[model samples]
Target chain A: MAHAADRRCVVIKADVHLAREGFTMDVQFQAEGSVLGVFGPSGAGKTTLINLIAGLEKPHRGSMALDQQTLFDAAQQIDVRTHQRRIGVVFQEHRLFPHYSVTGNLLYGARRENGDLDRVVTLLELSPLLDRRINQLSGGERQRIALGRALLSRPQLLLLDEPLASLDLRLRRQIIPYLRRVRDELRVPIVYVSHDLTEILQLTDQLLVLERGKSVGCGRYGEIVHTDAVLSVVHDRGMNNVLVARVLEHKAEDGVSVLEIGPREQGEPTGRLFAPLCAAEVGATVSISIRPWDIALAAAPVSGVSILNQVRGTVLRCTGHERRMLVDVNIGAPLIVEISRRSATTLHIEPGTPIVCLIKSHSVQFVGALGPGSPQ
Target chain B: MTPEEWSALLLSLRVALWSMAIMLVPGIACAALLARKKFPGKVILDAAIHLPLVLPPVVVGYVLLLSLGRHGWLGGWLYNSLGVEVAFTWKAAAIASAVMGFPLLVRAVRLAMELVDPRLEQAARTLGASPWRVFATITLPLALPGVLTGMVLAFARSLGEFGATITFAGNIEGATRTLPTAIYTYTQVPGGDGPAMRLMVISIALSFAALIASELCSRWLTRRIGAAL
Candidate 1:
């Protein structure tokens, strides 16, 4: 659908065919003014998708449009050159012009914005080190400058292809907040290419999980993060569940969340589920991640313990590996618990063991989801 | 040294400078083509570029003379269209020197272009720079050191070119004679040994200067790029 003479931000809509070094990808999706993450391993066409979006590579038989502009349409015989496409791209290495100072590299993109210099500089927070040479900056600082340069272009859309991959873990952590600020404050939509689930969780609302050059799953993180397809790749050797639980009340004395888990099934009682450090209000819903390892099994109702979660349930299955065991407990629903083989033998855990599972309230992590009422 | 030696040394410098200036563009263009693009007959093009390096200097000179002489095909067209005679002239001497030095220039430039990371160009493209803009703003600047090295090597080669210049441009004094031709002429004349020895010393100095200039240019370029980012 093409809109004429309208100022809606560019919406990426394309099916692309890219084949190189024995890998072939044919991906199609529509993205608007939200962070859409192309998540996959290296060589899974995540960066290729980004390059295609930025017009760095052409698709052989696909049609792509950004905003109302026709970028490429093999049938229509239209391919707007990269410079004319008004798309900003940042690479993993930053790729700052080696011949320019930090200011000059930033202005290289800023000057292309047609006189919106002040706005971009303000938005990306690039005022302090404007005069510094790019090579003189630290890895995190260089990435920030690179981000500022991309933003200065005032592009309809931005594509980031693993901008933090080259950084050490500490530097990566330092730059992540700035990435969020860009998403929050700027009007530009970003197509972030990353294989890191942590980045996907923190920075993006929408996701396209790629495997072998194909989109195996695509949805908001809430919808797909726990799905069989997403989980198969994400939790290959582990079992974790992200539950949309409401913080019913906080026991500050013990630092735990009395979370209301699951939906009201018309007749079922809404019981309190204990989570680690309740950070939300009494009625505020937060997606809490429960790792299987944080749960413990007890054959009886053990008292006089700091472990606040003592849920009564029947053991569905007990599977043991060389060092660890996966115990499936049906606490109204199936909850997976991971324990060491020593603990399994010590507790004498087995299938159909009517047991109480204990979870320390501080072990639950609060992570939100992209629901219908999510911020735009 | 003597007036004759000074004249020959000055003539060599002039011939090399002019020849280098003439071939710089073509050499860079060829190098860029070889580095960036591939097509049918690419191997053949590569071989053709290296022909001057493989061929004997005298054979190269004879080929130049056959094609650029007064009655030859290109020479006839030049004479008929522009009344310009190239063979047996200083211009022919410069052309011969450039031919001898062309391989050196092309090889240096091609190596430099190859070393330039192609990812930088792709980054430029994503920044909304056109192909030509990327070449001008990114590729050309990054490859300047290599181009300078090529130019110096070519100039040095041109300064010492003897067989090609003598065969194509002849040994006329102050007209077609360059340093190498003058040296050739002096060796033939009796009692010209002193002048010939002085010219040989001048040739060595000039080659050393060219090398130093190339080294300085490369270091400066490296520093400039390193300081910027």
Candidate 2:
């Protein structure tokens, strides 16, 4: 019973110390999951953490271990060579060999003894792209091939460093499903490093938040975002409230998709949020992101309001900085509502006060097609 | 052309080809090391590789003679242990050419190696390739155009070699007498204008052909590697 946690997953214990270009990186964290997201802003040692894990770069002094394997132990002078580490990496630039065809690039690192080449090729939908030259593939296609190639390498752990950062919004959406499939079907343990909070949440709930070469926090997105200091850093990026919901009904005439926030039994009417017409099956779960500015607080239910989503909740707290005020309303999930000081004072919004929160269906962005694990 | 002239042309081609062949692997190895690696004697090694480019060709030839001649250190070892004689022979001419051309070969390949993004090599490393395999598959193929350019440059330099070849090989007729050495012989002798002029035209034609061939080959290689994104 004492070792029950050790058997379920691989434990990545990283205590890395590296210095480059006047920036010294001394960050440490333990990640245990199928997909651990490394969250950080630009130049915050996000990629550095990934590089050290993949053995692309060595730490000046530290020890790294994965699932009982000693990767780098500076004290013992034990550094596993990159090739021998069996850790696959998909760089942000998607570094596919230009001289090779799609299939050649995919098979570059594939293991002859035990590599699932055809399965990955099919999983990432790479059959039509096998014979094409790398130059001919689009940005999304290149990333798919890169993902397939890394998976074909038969790595014990896959490190993806902002695999969709270089892509546009459309391309990012296109690649998110492939990432979900990698996690769900293949069930390979992955370390996904990204600066985008929403994108990170799309793939996994567990995260290691980094700031300026230091790990500020590491936990579920719902838990780590509550810290006052962590909230301030994330606030600078206009962070939004996210809720895991499942699609219930898609009405084309209304141009809205009804999504339930919790498990919808036969008669248990759970909270339902509506978003614009989304390409989701009737029972599929999705992560919806609502910007704080789009949420409106009301003292009572009012008609003639064009907004579709109205949830009853209590005001947790209200705080203001500069010209914006953040009103935390507990609507099943913590939803931050941005409002002017005039309205906060006029409505007399305070902690423990019952309120009705209204948000337009159009404002609710369906950001991610999460697997069945979502929709609590 | 007379048989003597024909022989000079053929001997020059042979020496140049031999020189390029001798430096190919070592040239790329030196270039890869100089461009990608940081070692204790890096700057010193770089300066030594480029010594022939800066110092006089005759000085390089003298050094080669002292170190590689029959009675010289390495030359003595080679002759005594391996029964291979290299002083004042066509092999000596080729050695002289390789030495003078060494700087050019390394410079071109080094520049190409530098242009290759180290990230690509790192990507290959993370994809389960050994360091040597990464160099062979990613680094070598990407730098192919530059490698080809360096080889052609070294071959051209060897073909036109005069000071180093004459100083070390002694210009033996029908053996070490390459095109440039033969041209020098004609120019020095009285009433040698006919042979010298004929050889001059032939030398220009051959040099141009070599240049055109090198250009085409490098362009083809670049096309095969595809343009950098």
Candidate 3:
């Protein structure tokens, strides 16, 4: 996670206000991360916000800057054209050119002197698809090519408008690894927009939540998820806590794998949790996601239970929703556990209160396996 | 066929090809404009481009004569300034056929251009391609089948051009007499039905071959682009 600090520079600053026939979008936010996930529901002007950033749509007023370069300024009457903006976009539909082969499409926007084509093709595993026609590619293959095409353009910024939305659940999981590779390998900053919070969380914890064309919250996922505005939108969608963990060992006879969660400091409060056996080698880092409601909060450890994990942690904050309460617990890494309001009252869960978090071995799902070079 | 018939057939092919070449670029330009642009007088411009499709071919020829005839405004300027003669010449025959066939070319190409997905062009722009580059690399190639169809239609129209060629360029046997005009000339004399029928058969065969060639080309192009036009 130390590499994440290098990408903390502000990538985009947009304060734009637009009003079309039936919808109006007035949002102001600054994106700073290797990947800033834009999360919102349908008709929340998510696409419009990206369009304005990509220069595909004009804002009636306000200004935008990318990497501290002025992209659009209404008071200055400066609006850079889309092509001159040098921002590559991967639309939801792939939008590949029907006339060009895979190689041609990739090279259509490549900067020849840089010679990054081979790197991009190799990174995305596109060598075999080079000669194939666009229509001949599968949904996953087409998305890979689209991503490669945008990467080869040498863009200062990348805009992904639901790049995986068109794919099925399995296909989306397949593409997420490639996207992670791009984020780690490429220097280009990315602005990924999707309505699925789980999908966004898998990429980066920093999110810009949009509700009805307005910014509800913008910050770390753990810090903002408990807010009323973000909760209402993400509650029904099933919010999950995404964490990076390192494989400690595997108990093959016991049919469970042990993983060390959170930072690797000498005196850190990292906890070892049991998960289902996975193919990842020991010492490799993997991303795991667990639903909030899957974990039960207990006042103290129980010995006679069948649960595989009962890690002790201190509660940070608790927010009561309509029927459920979201308890933020710092068990090495921050985890949001959803429990009944009655449970909170019985357990006396509040800031600085010690508690035990109950979990099952199969509750943790392996979302993705990071490459060897990526730090945990 | 006699030398007279051979000359007529060759001249008709030459005129038809020249007509297609003359109209190809402008026809595509007009089609792209009509398909992708909006401005004042768009409806009027569209109607004017399609005038030949609905109006009599003789009237179109007469209008060309009025503007580009030897003593006419544009023709006189060309004659005086550049010492160029355009009336009753082979070039005039090509122009006459091109004018008559222009509407078909524009209509087919416009339909094709209209069918091109605008999102692809937007993607290209975001990929750092200029607007013109987007048109050349994405829009035009996707609409290629329609363009081929339009060219074939214009070529066939030029081959069968009679009234416009007759009215503007006159029926000069070696210079301006295309297939239909030659057929008309042969039918005028007594006992000339044999040559007239021969020329008529050649006209039908030429049109048929052009159509079949167009269909094959469009299919191949559509397959190359991997989509139905």
Report, for every candidate in turn, its global Cα lDDT versus the true structure.
0.75, 0.84, 0.88
Chain B TM per candidate, please?
0.95, 0.96, 0.97
Residues A182-255, candidate 3: write the lDDT tens digits. 77777567889998877888788889989888888888888888988888888777588888788999899899
Tell me each candidate's TM-score. Answer: 0.79, 0.88, 0.95
After superposition, the stretches of candidate 3 with alpha carbons farther than 4 Å from their true spots are A263-269, A372-376, B227-229
Docking quality (DockQ) of candidate 3 = 0.70
Candidate 2's error at B42, in angstroms?
A: 1.6
* Models ranked on lDDT: 3, 2, 1
Candidate 1 chain B weakest lDDT stretch, 10 residues: B1-10
The RMSD of every model to the true structure, in order and in angstroms, is 7.7, 4.5, 2.4
lDDT, model 3, position A192: 90
The residue pairs that clash in candidate 2, if any, are: none
- Model 1 segments more than 4 A misplaced: A1-10, A112-118, A237-359, A364-376, B226-229
Candidate 1 lDDT over A1-376, as tens digits, reads 1111122334667777776778888887776546787787777788778777777788888888876778899889898888877788889888888887777777775554266556656655667777777777877778788888888777778888899899987566556656665665665677888877656655655778887787767876544544555656655522354455666776778766588665444334435678766445667655566778888888898989988778888887776664667777777655778788998898888878888878887777665532312311
TM-score of 1: 0.79
Q: Which segments of candidate 2 are over 4 A away from where they belong?
A: A1-8, A252-255, A262-271, A279-285, A292-307, A312-359, A369-376
- Model 3: share of real contacts kept: 0.88
DockQ comparisons of all candidates to the true complex: 0.44, 0.60, 0.70
